[model samples]
Target: LPHRYPFLLIDRIIELDIPNLKVKALKNVTVNEEFFNGHFPEYPVMPGVLIIEAMAQAGAYLMIKKLKAEGADGDFTVLFAGIDSAKFRKPVRPGDQIIFEIEGLNIKKSMGKIKGVAKVDGQVVCEAVLMAALKKS
Candidate 1:
């Protein structure tokens, strides 16, 4: 995912369906997270932006995998171009495992749009429509 520890949000890819343009990924939040220390010392909560970022990563994975399956070869990087209709439904905390479901809405050339939903314990924590661009790196 081109991301390293502390910044990489996704822990695993549970599902990948290139034909369907969908992907599911997981992120395990822990008390040791660097953001928890400052987000709230008294009562820590996962930042909403990070949840969205997790979803974006999952979408990026889907796009990259799809591109590879199509035999397009390159060192590519996906960058967020925009986010729309983002909503935070619940607060995430340490020990919570987040599941990100991403479905491609549109993909043309180097640009793509996806609908992302973040869930914890089967309950939605956040949802957003993400736009991204793929560029050779």
Candidate 2:
């Protein structure tokens, strides 16, 4: 939450179903966002990579919450290991709020697989299969 601009893709966590290992997150897009300026002035669309980043953020949040709930006492950092089977179905533009939904596919001690989707106005804009590593912070 203390993270700064550009790095912070997640706006809020809407739901956390720990038993299902599922979470819903959001990112509000605005014209004032820096990326729009360079991503293309005439045709501004959120980058595909940023969409993936948003999904990763959701996965990281879920992992942190799960660990803390179990009273695990170690500093941890989550890092992206890989992304697969990613697809962009629609373009996301400014003034749109993207809903990022992610669910754990499998969880290991230090690594896990998750599936994510980015949606806007009830439409899926992008989705991916993500792998991340959780390590000591």
Candidate 3:
């Protein structure tokens, strides 16, 4: 949610279950994507790290929303604290819609962990476990 254009990865939220700490989001990759230009001029494949970022964004969105519902202010920011078990299972190209499945692993006063998976056509493309910390401005 703190990301801006060319950085903001998640396009939309398709499903959100706060009580269960789950969130599903989407991102449509297009030929016009800025990364496509330099990532590869002849053949382009979405960078695996961006897919992980998308998943983390989705996860952070869930945490922020849940925090707000619990009476926390919207002024807090989510910062990536750690990433682990990241695996790239498939290549993502233009015109592909990435689906992010984020499940909350744990949440404390200012820290959280989320297990995230990025999928396309129902196949996993990338996945990772992310840790984040909430900072108030």
Best candidate, lDDT-wise? 1
Ranking of all predicted structures according to lDDT, beginning with the best and ending with the worst:
1, 3, 2
Each model's lDDT: 0.93, 0.88, 0.90
- Tell me the tens digit of each residue's lDDT in model 1 across 50-82: 999889999998988888888888878999999
Assess every candidate by TM-score: 0.98, 0.95, 0.96
Please give the distance, in angstroms, between residue 26's alpha carbon in candidate 3 and its true position after superposition. 0.2
Candidate 2 differs from the real structure by a C-alpha RMSD in angstroms, to one decimal, of: 1.3
Residue 59 in model 2: lDDT: 90
Candidate 3's TM-score: 0.96
In model 3, what is the error at residue 108, expressed in angstroms? Answer: 2.0
Which residue pairs come into collision in candidate 3?
none
Report the CA-based lDDT of candidate 2 relative to the real structure.
0.88
| Segments in model 2 whose C-alpha atoms lie over 4 Å from true places | none
RMSD of each: 0.7, 1.3, 1.0
